[model samples]
Target: MTKIADLRSQTVDQLSDELLKLKKEQFNLRFQAATGQMEKTHRVSEVRKDIARISTLLREKRAAS
Candidate 1:
């Protein structure tokens, strides 16, 4: 899990890249859950929250500019 403070220090481009990666992982987790192959079910929510955190930070950065 990524801390909000750590995310806040990253550049927008870096945050975007991290968001994309998290989204991809989210997709895979959903697929695995559907197929009954998911091991760490809690990870789904963790990734989702991380994506939200990054998005919120990005918006804050844009608004501050």
Candidate 2:
């Protein structure tokens, strides 16, 4: 797994793609949980944190411009 700093180093486009992917994964996790098929359910929280981290970095990067 990539570190938050490493993720921050990426370009906006890359970060956007990753953010989208994370959201999709989060959706799937919710579905799995609802169906009682989720393994490692704690992962959902981690994904949320990652999304927030990425978004915060993105905002910082933009504001620095």
Clash pairs detected, candidate 2:
none
What is the alpha-carbon lDDT for the whole of candidate 2?
0.89
| Model 2 TM-score on a 0 to 1 scale | 0.90
> Candidate 2, which ten residues in sequence have the lowest lDDT sum?
1-10
Please give, for residues 1-65, the per-residue lDDT of candidate 1 as tens digits. 99888998899999999999999999999999999999999999999889989999999988998
Q: On residues 4-26, what C-alpha lDDT tens digit does candidate 2 reach at each position?
A: 87996799889989999999999
TM-score of each: 0.96, 0.90
Clashes of 2: 0
CA lDDT scores, all candidates in order: 0.93, 0.89
Over 4 Å off, model 1? none
